[model samples]
Target: QQQVKQSPQSLIVQKGGISIINCAYENTAFDYFPWYQQFPGKGPALLIAIRPDVSEKKEGRFTISFNKSAKQFSLHIMDSQPGDSATYFCAAPYNQGGKLIFGQGTELSVKP
Candidate 1:
C-alpha cells in the first residue's frame, strides 16, 4: 500500500511565528495532495491542496509546496496562532477507488 511519510510528530511555535510540516510519498501515480486540519472534537477539514502541475499554492495563511521530482510536499502555516493548534495530516487519493491514504499526522501547538 502507498503511504505518505510525515515528519515531526509534534511542533510548537510562537503565536506570531511559522509552523512547517513535511511529507514524502512513494507512489508516482498519486496526483493530488491535500492537507487537513482537525480540532479536538471535530472531524478533519481540508486546509489546502496542490496538484503535481503546480509547484506551489497558497490560501490565506496556509501554503502547500510540491516537488514532483522528489515526490514530496510540505505545508507552511504563516502567523501561527492558538486557534491554529490542531492535528494536521497530509494525504493522497488512491488511484482506483479515490480513497485517501493519510500520513501519521502532526500535532501543532501555537503558544502565546
Candidate 2:
C-alpha cells in the first residue's frame, strides 16, 4: 500500500526548544518528500522540502532530514517558539505529481 506513517501524534515543547516529527514510507513511487505546517484555521502550507538526492536541507529554523536507505524522513524545528505551534504533516507526491499522500499529522504545542 502507498502510505506515509508519522509518529508523535501530539507534542509539547517549551519555547526555544527543538521539535521533531518523523515519518516513514514504503512506496518507491514517492519521488519527493515535503513537510507542511498548518494553523488551526489555515490550510497546510509547504514549510520545507528536500530533493530526492539530498541527505538533508536546512532553512532558517526548519530542517528536513532524509534517509533514502531507511525509507524515512524527519522535520526539525530549532529554537521553536510559541508562534510555531501548529499541526505538521509530511507528504509525498505519487502518480507523477497527480496525487499526494500525507502522514498522520503531529499537533504541536509550544509552551511559553
Candidate 3:
C-alpha cells in the first residue's frame, strides 16, 4: 500500500483548546514519518515527526502520537490559537530520494 488517509478535512477549535487529527497508512515498508504545516500560498514546512522506533514526539505546541501496530498516527495541537489556523499534512518517504506521499490535507482553524 502506498497511501496515507487523513480525516476531518477541516477542523475548528477554540483558542487554548486541543486540535486533533488522525491518519492511517497501509504500507508497512514506509519509514521516516513526518508531518508538515502550511499556510495559505506557502510551501509546507516540517512541523514535527516521529519514526516507527518511537511511539510519540512533541515540539512546542505540537505533538505526534503514533501507533505502529495499528499503522496509524495523529497530530495534537496544544494551546490552540487563531494564528494556528493552517493546513497540515502527514507524510512519509517512499524511498531515499525524499519524495513524500501526503495525506489528503487537513485545514485547522483555531478561533479566537
lDDT of every model, 2 decimals: 0.92, 0.92, 0.88
Q: Which ten residues in a row have the lowest lDDT in candidate 2?
A: 91-100
- Expressed as tens digits, the lDDT of each residue in 14-103 for candidate 2 is 999999999998885656898999999999999999988789999999999999989999999999999999999998875665588999
lDDT of 3 by residue, 14-87 (tens): 99999999988877445567888999999999899897677989999999998887888999999998998999
Candidate 1: minimum summed lDDT over ten consecutive residues — where? Answer: 92-101
Sorted by TM-score, highest first, which candidate order results? 1, 2, 3
Error of 1 at 50 (Å): 0.6
- How many residue pairs clash in all the candidates, one count each? 0, 0, 0
Residue lDDT tens for model 1, 1-112: 7778998899999999999999998884558999999999999998999987789999999999999889889999999999999999999886767788899999999999
- Report how far off residue 91 is in candidate 3 (Å): 0.5
Superposed by TM-score, candidate 3 places the C-alpha of residue 10 at a distance from the truth, in angstroms, of: 0.4
